[model samples]
Target: MRRLLWPAAVLVLLLALNVFFTPSFLAIQVRDGHLYGSLIDILRFGAPLILVALGMTLVIATGGIDLSVGSVVAISGALACLRISEDAGVLAAVAPALGLCLLLGAWNGFLVAGVGIQPIIATLILMVAGRGLAQLITGGQIITVNDEAYKMIGGGYWLTVPFGVLIVLAVLAITAFLTRRLALGMLIESVGGNAEASRLAGIRSRGIIVMVYAFAALCAGVAGLMISSNVSSADGNNAGLWIELDAILAVVIGGTSLAGGRFSLAGTVLGALIIQTLTTTVYSIGVPPETTLLFKALVVTAVCLIQSPSFRAKVFRRRGGTAPPAAVAEEKARVREEVPPDGVRS
Candidate 1:
């Protein structure tokens, strides 16, 4: 919880800025029995990112990365939309798409865990190959579907709340239970902390690594479905372009170590919300559309620096005109050694 303070503060600051720009930014009203507000929009649109980051958090905790998630997102949506366009039922289309995502995930896991490939390189292979695979599935075209049932997953409302938001909540709860309630979280952390030691301790580190990658892909797959379903189309070339970057950013912002070990799901969700809110802020504040990415990059960089403990320690030391504790202790020891028995300086 202490680790989350900085991120939470930053998110609040961003939201406050939005409130200043748009007075009604935080206002929520029920319209036709449906809740509507900027905050709601953020949650609805950011749902996919939240899911992707959740999976990335787990994989990162296990000392592995999955660069193929963006590609998996593209492939999942493309396959689902393509099947739907062929007059298949929504369930039929979604099931196969998710299954393929699982297979792709397992294949990535196999490469990294079984064949001993580096996680980045192993996933990167699929990252590049999967795009072509998605294009092939779509015949180099955007597949659009008119299935109302499918739309409900991403865009439709239920009980005055976005269904996508509900999905995120459900997924979050399940992930929490699996990792926290069960022994899975400890196992993942042990492997991440020291893979060789974990293996020696009979933890089956390889299997855990494979499982995390598979889980990451599964989350990406669900995100893909939500995106395509909301838009009612899947552009193989652009469905989930660069989403992995955002997911990684969210995980880092949420206080997850890229080096792997401990993770915080709540922090990841907050991080994702911060990012989505930042995007919304850009538009509301009237920043130039062309410069939006640059603006976002600058803010994110500042947030990261603020969250860095080393950076803060240096800043505080400079402001307080004090050296670090180690330096001060060393100086004290040197002075003590130099002093004579009379308790005076040499």
Candidate 2:
């Protein structure tokens, strides 16, 4: 909970800033039996990112990175859209897409776990090549489909809320159950903390690695479906472009170390919300298009610094009051050294 404070606070501040700009930023209304508001829009549109980051949280927890997730997103969306365009059932399109993503992830795991390639290099290979795969699937053209059932997955409403949000919730719940209620989370952490030690302790670190990579790819697959379904088209070149970076950033913001170990699904969710809200704030405040990325960078940097304990200590030290524990202890030791044996000031 403490770890989540900075991200939660930052999210709140961003939302408050938007209220200043849009005046009605917090106003949520139901129109024609559908909920509508800026906040609702953030949750709906950010659902895909939340899903991606959720998978990222697990992968990073296992001390690996999956650069290919963005490409997987493109490929998944392309293949699913292509199948649907061919008059395939929505189930047929989705199952195959997700299965392929799972295989792609397993391939990456094989390269890293089986072939002993560094994770970065292994995933990078797929990152570059998967785009071509997606292009091939879509024949270098956007595949547009008109399936109402498919659209419901990403853009439709359920119980007055975005169905995408519900999907995210379901995925999050399942992930939490798998990681928290079971032994899977601990095994992953152990593997990440020290692969050799875990192996010596009889944990199948290799299998865990494979499973997490596959899971990450699976999450990206779902995100791809959501993105393409929302738009009713899949662009091999543009679908989920650069989303991996955002997912990594969200994991970091959520207090997950890239070095791998402990993870918090709730924190990751909050981090994703913060990022989406930041995007909303930028658009609401009329930030110039060219400066948008730079603006986001600055804000993110501030939030990260606030979340860093060492950075906070440095700030406190420089403030000339409320010295950090180490500084206070040092000062006390110095005073004791200078004082006389009678406990009086020199």
Candidate 3:
């Protein structure tokens, strides 16, 4: 129940906010056979954050963080837009765009996993320099690409559903499959739980870490493509700006602690949805657009605090009058197991 509390709270908060701000926010329409409005927009815009959070989950599960993702998004979008502008064949350019993303991921992996650098510090270098690379690609200006292929990636739809959202779902499905069905979650948890122990156990901990970082870049690449498609242009300075904050917030809000350990893809999805809903609620309630971010930050901070062990315990104690019997028993059992017996077990 403790593990479930945070997510459940967020769900209720989402519903409440929707009910108060937009009466029809939860109404899913199949009008002309299409879903639309704020709800759909929430899902659509939240897709990229969902993708980023998926990769962040793996990286965090490995006891690492990738700050380079926002920059990677900028670079990928800039490069792809530039290529299409050059009139390079669609496949020819997109292939290289993807290759570049993969290579960037590899570079991040090499630095953090192979060179023995702190993940945050290692990714920081790219986070700073990568934007400059993107600026160079776009000649310090937003570049518009009138490519049909690129448009399909961001703006095209299938059966009246957003293709970008579908892509995000596909990535989510892949992540869920890999982590849940393949025991990858166990491996990641083990690695994050104890990197040295994993190394001693002959696990390819470094390789795993590298793969996670690389996957993060790949995720960022997809986000960049979608963002560029939506605008029909790439702005290195603005594309995915501050998205790292949202990604990290989503992960934390989903109950994936930043300190690292286990991860939940489903929780991450719900987290992204929560964020989008909150944003929608804020906008619908007529808050100034500039203040939207301030509100988001405050809400995220509140979530992080609530998820903190100390805070949760405090809250639990304050509400102890209504403590559930099952929870009390579980707490007692945990205490007994944690404490040594009065005498030796033998």
Candidate 4:
């Protein structure tokens, strides 16, 4: 319960701000009986961050980060848009695009895992260079496609639920299955908790590290497809600008430590939701655009402080809370208390 302090605090703050600034922010209204309003917009548009953060949870869990994901998003969107044609079959268009994404993923994996380069330094190469590659692919122009099947990746509806939301949910479900059903958590923890110890235990840490980066690239690809669908055009610059910050912010806000250890996918999902809601609230209420970034920064800092070791200890000691000796058990107990009944804790 205590482990969840920071994420819960962030969720509460996001909700409170929405309610105070935008009276109907939480109220999901219907226009002509179809879903409409601030809440829906938050859910629909925030799907991209949710997808990116899901991959980030895995990478950060292994004591690494992938800075090139934004670039991957751009490349994936560009490829998908460039290949869209009135004559191409659905599979012809989408499969090749996703294949390119997987190749990029493999490349990232090779650089980070095979070459023994630091995650940040390795991903940075792609981050700086991949955008230029994407622009070159598009001939430095935004490509708009009119393919119906491809357009549905982002703009289609699923039984009144947005396809974008469904895609995010599908990825979340798969991730949950891998982590929970397969006990992959133990493998990840072994690697992150102590790489030397895990290697001694015969766990292939390098492969796992590569897998994490590859998985991150895969996620960015999905996000790119969805984003381009929303706009009906592939604009590399605007598709996922500064979203790496948002992904990092979501992970931290969701209670996943940047230092890397145990992780919570559920918490990350909620963190993404909170971020979307905050942005929607800011826009709905017409707050000065200049203050929005400042406000978000302040909120992130506050959440991080709440999760910091010093503050946690201070609150725990002052409140006379005691933790069990086993580190894993202690963290789990702490997380439970921090998570609200209505909110997910990372």
Candidate 5:
């Protein structure tokens, strides 16, 4: 509960602001046997980010990053749509697209795990080339599909709630079970805490690293399917542009260190919701389209500053005085223990 304070507070603050700006923000009504409201829209639109961030949490926990998720998203959607456009059955389309995603993920894992490439550079290789491959698959044109069954994945409602929300919930539950309910989470933390030490201790660090990267790619692929299905089309150039940045931001804001170690899936979900709410709030407040990005950046920066312990400490020091000697010593000790000798950024 203590670990969740910042993200929870940020989420509440964003929702309160939305209520003030849009009186109907909290109102939910049943329409055609389905839920409809700003809140519902936030959850629906945020599902993709939630999925992507969940995978990212694990990758970051392994002291690695996957910059190619956005490109994988594009490639996933493009391949799925291309197959569908060619009269492939929906199952046929989905299976092949996921298989491709798995292969793409495996390739990334091979680079970082098998070939010993730095995680960033290894993933960046695909980040740059994957989008080009997506373009090639679609011939630089959007491929549209009209299959209702496929559209249900992203746009349909079930039990009066958006299907996308259900999908997110299911994935979250499964991931939590896998990571927390078993020893897998412990092994992952060990690897993140100190890869070489864990390796010597008999943990299969390489296999864990490969698994996480592949999982991140798999999540990105699912998000891609949702995005393409929502609009019934795949635009390789625009499908998931910059979404990787958003997922990274969500992970960081949720208290997951970029340097790696512990993580919280619930916090990541809240962060995603806050991001989605912020986007909706910007439009509801009638911020000019051209300046929306600027507004968002300002708000995000404020949130980050508020969440930073160092920033808070500095502000408190200016207002009052320094911490007791014991407290300062403890803080320094904790930092020294947590940070690696290589000066890895957290």
Candidate 6:
């Protein structure tokens, strides 16, 4: 709960800012039995990000990172759109795209786990090559799909809520269940904490690492479908571009350490929302398109600094605050032990 405090606070603050700038930011109206508002738009646009970050949380938890998710997103979207353009059935289009995503994941896992390449390098291989692969699949042109069913995956409504929102919720629920209701979370954490120790203890660290990478790719694939389906086309060059950075940022902002160990799905969700909200806020405030990146970078840096313990300590000291109670006690204990009771130093 405490770990989620900063992200929750930041999200609320951003939402409040939105409300102030755009009075209708929270206004939702039902038209044709479907909810509509800026808030809904945020959720809809942020859905893909949520999926990507969820997978990233697990990979980061395993002390590994997947830099290829953005590429995977492109490949998945391209393949799906290409099949649909070729008049393939919806299931036929989607199944093969998702299967290819898994194979891409396997390739990443093989390089990292089996071949012992560094994770960043292993994943980077795909990151650089994936766009080309997507371009090749689409013949360097945007593949447009006229399939309404496919578009529904990214844009339609259900029960007065965006279908994309429902998809996000379903993914979130399933991931939470898998991590919390089973030993999978523990195994991943163990591998992250100390792979050699976990291996000694009979945990299949390699297998777990491979599985996580594969799972991350699967999540990226789903996000690809959402993105391309939303637009009814796959632009291999631009689909999911730079999203990997955003997913990594979301994972970091969600209180997950790059060093690995414990993680919180709820935190990642909030982080994704915060990011989406921030993007919306930028547009609402009319930041120049040319300067938007600079503005966003500044805001992100501030958030990261605010979330840094060392930075907090510096701020606290400048405000005339002492160490925390536990730190004070530990320091006193150390001093007492260092200076013998009768003034005799050991």
Candidate lDDT scores, in order, read 0.91, 0.90, 0.80, 0.77, 0.88, 0.89
lDDT (tens digit, per residue) of candidate 1 on 83-113: 9999999999999999999999989889988
TM-score of 2: 0.93
lDDT of 5: 0.88
Which stretch of 10 consecutive residues in model 3 shows the poorest summed lDDT?
A: 337-346
Total clashes in model 3, counting residue pairs 3 or more apart in sequence or in different chains:
0
Model 2: per-residue lDDT, tens digit, 1-346? 7678889999989988888878888999999899999989999999999999999898898889999999999999999999999999999999999999999999998888889899899999999999999999999998889999999999999999999999999999999999999999999988877788789999999999999999999999999999999999999998989999999999999988787877889999998999899988888899999999999999989988888766676788789666678645544644554454777632
Residue 329 lDDT (model 3): 59
Better of 1 and 6 by lDDT: 1
Could you tell me which residue pairs clash in candidate 3? Answer: none
* Model 2: pairs clashing at backbone N, Cα or C within 3 Å: none
Residues 187-274, model 4: lDDT tens digits:
8856766666678889998888777878888888889888887888887666677787899888877777676767888888877887
Better of 4 and 6 by lDDT: 6
**How many pairs of residues collide in each model?**
0, 0, 0, 10, 0, 0
Q: Write the per-residue lDDT of candidate 6 for residues 78-153, one digit (tens) a residue.
A: 9999999989988999999999999999889889889999999999999999989999999999888899999998
Candidate 5, run of 10 with poorest lDDT:
323-332
Put down candidate 3 lDDT per residue, 208-319, tens digits, no spaces. Answer: 8888888989999888888888889999888888788778777777766565667777777777777777777787778888888888788778877765555555567687
Could you tell me every candidate's TM-score relative to the true structure? Answer: 0.92, 0.93, 0.89, 0.87, 0.94, 0.93
After superposing candidate 5 on the true structure, give the runs of residues whose Cα lies further than 4 Å from its correct spot. Answer: 322-346
Give candidate 6 misplaced runs (Cα > 4 Å).
323-346
